[model samples]
Target chain A: MTAWITYVVTAAGLTLVALIRPFLGRQNELFGVVFGTRNIRQDQVGRSLKQQYLIETLSLAVLVWGGLALMAWWHQQPPYLALGMIAFLLAALAATANAHRLSSQYHQQLAVPEAMRVSVDLTQLANEQTLSPVWGMVLLPLVGVGFALPWSAVAWANLTVGLVVGGTFLLTRHLAANVHGLAAAPGAAQARNILLSFLLAVAVVAQGFGLACAWQPAQAGLFSLVFGLLTLLGLLLLLITWLQVTRRQAPAGAVRTDNARWYWGVFYYAPNDSSLFVTKRIGVGLTLNYAHPASWFLLLGVVAVVATIAVLSN
Target chain B: MELTVDFASTVPIYTQIRNAVIQAIADGRLKSSEVLPSVRALGSALGVNYHTVNKAYTQLADEGFITMRRGLGAMVAEQLPAVDPHFEAEVVPQMKALFTEAKVRTVDRQTLVALIDQVYDEGWHH
Candidate 1:
């Protein structure tokens, strides 16, 4: 099979999974990282389960189709692989944005009763998980070895990307250490830190493979095998974590406001709320409070950056 | 320590935060010299602006209920400040107004005393 066929298959499979996710489990239990809402009360959200499913399915279908079309058009030209990648990336982003918009609409329609609204304790929310700086120091030698090996432009570019991505994970660890209240929820904090470390390790190893590929292009088959295996393993790890999070019960006294004041049960917008980001009442992630002006600026900034990256990468 | 703010309440968000910390301290959930969450972290967790948390922390610091260090964040004060000499003067009028309203509502002196005793027993500060 051509490389483009593999990309098309993967994209289609993932979209199909997303479309069928709601039916596979309890409504509240199905947490979509990018496209799904948290445990919003169905009655209050004003959207039937079928409606949400339809919305996600249609958006994802469009995404997959767009990606497939791009792959098909660029398939004959190996030099256009970068353009294909950019097209797929943009399609994915659009799908996510569409999902967010639909989710926000549902949230805006919610009618939360006063009694169910609860407040979060800042102290308890403080994150205390930390990773030692020594871990980064230990990886410096691998980076040195990678640099010492002979390199090509593409190999150097891949290595640079890997290092940058790996460095982000390390930076996240450092930032997480300073965040208060993370320690209060040690399980989540520790899991997040471990995931970051795992990603960092994977990036470093991937850099080594880039070096190998640069040195001996004939061994590309072996590298692809290893890459495929790693991808599968990463997906497995993600699935395990997602299950653990969704299965875990909400803590006692968690605010279960049925209100759609949170745009789409994801982007929160309570004018009185002074926080820029709040822990999700129904899910494992943090949501930006749209009521805060800075939240909009931040969201816009993120979109701009991603759009720029997609363009430049193409 | 548990903290909550009612967005619909007339109470200011900063005051709610400040009062919650004070209540935690009184309930012994937050101990003397215990480090409190950083303003930014708490703000992010609660979905409030960091400045709102900073305001609460600053107010607590001003009241000598907590101390703020540059890198260490805020910590509960080892010794809470003594009540101001004018505290009684400031409180008595409010207390009298409350009692007058209770009396007008036909609440007996005994019931008022009982309520006060219960709240006092619950402990705001040691």
Candidate 2:
């Protein structure tokens, strides 16, 4: 029963996030494509695309949930549960990709000759936007000590997962600090505050869960339930913040319609852009600038870390 | 001080940075001895090559607008540099070109003098 409840919570939370992801960006964006100051909701083409996106996403969600229900009845097992979760993720990605492709058809072209352009707020240089570097530096050692105090195979696995989350938290801070025009974007500060706070909460929860599982694996189900509830709360906060951000008008000269630099209305590629991370055209956070040489290194580092963790866990 | 560089501008990025800093200093937007962001940070924030910002800083230093100390980063000079003969010599041709353009455009002497006066007074008041 506990397992069933956990699966349901996880599925519901993921579905909510997927449903809201399409509308969680600047007002000028439509499915990750920039359309300048044009009102996407009022534009005929944009309205049609949005309706299509909703219909597709809802249909996929229904199919995935129906499959999960069948899997639950036929075989109430962990492997089947994992398979169902994987199917849902794949479906969500497919729906989003289709929407993105459809929206790319209307991407506006600007007269600017550059493939990508960056704007910086000179006055905001002194302001500290991300969490302090000291926290990121200290997190790993503290978590390591916690893992060592009660050593077990479960502890080792928990340690691996904790390290991954901790590394992501640190990387997020780095990207947040490097984002161009983060300080100048309207409603960006509020959105960033919400995101950073949620990440900090998740990091803390991860550490606590790791230690809890190490000490008492029997209560893992209870901890999973608590984690799911917190996740749901976080996603709700994110959705509310997204709505507020998407409602605010983009300031004059703020919207860069550099659709040429973005392939498939998602991946950013501009060789002349020296930034490793730029503010996302489609989402609230930063996206990788694939043209930067260092981005490849960063990607490799993440892959290496995940691979190491996988090998260690086994 | 808000510095903006347009990619479409005919002026090079480094020159734009140099001009913006000079203008900010003239208008008192950049106070004396104020520290500036490191070249790498500015370059990253602007999504430009670090060397571009380094060149701007080097020119600013050469022009006596800012001081750069190794490892300490750039700082606005404690005292604004006086206009040297070399600087005046460089400005002469530019001014002459503008004056000739104004003449060709049929701008009257009084209007031209008033425009110059307005521009000169605008910087000091800041």
Candidate number achieving the greatest DockQ relative to the actual structure: 1
Which portions of model 1 show Cα errors greater than 4 Å? A1-4, A20-111, A114-141, A146-191, A248-251, A256-314, B84-126
> Which portions of model 2 miss their true places by more than 4 Å?
A1-11, A42-44, A63-91, A107-121, A128-130, A137-141, A147-184, A238-254, A304-314, B35-45, B49-51, B68-74, B82-126
Question: Against the true structure, what is each candidate's TM-score?
Answer: 0.64, 0.74
- The count of backbone overlaps in candidate 2 is 0
Highest TM-score scorer? 2
Writing each residue's lDDT as its tens digit, candidate 1 over A19-92 gives: 54433222332222211223443444324644655575666566556655665667753223445455544654
Q: Return the lDDT, model 2, position B26.
A: 84
All candidates' lDDT scores? 0.57, 0.68
DockQ of each: 0.37, 0.33
DockQ of 2: 0.33
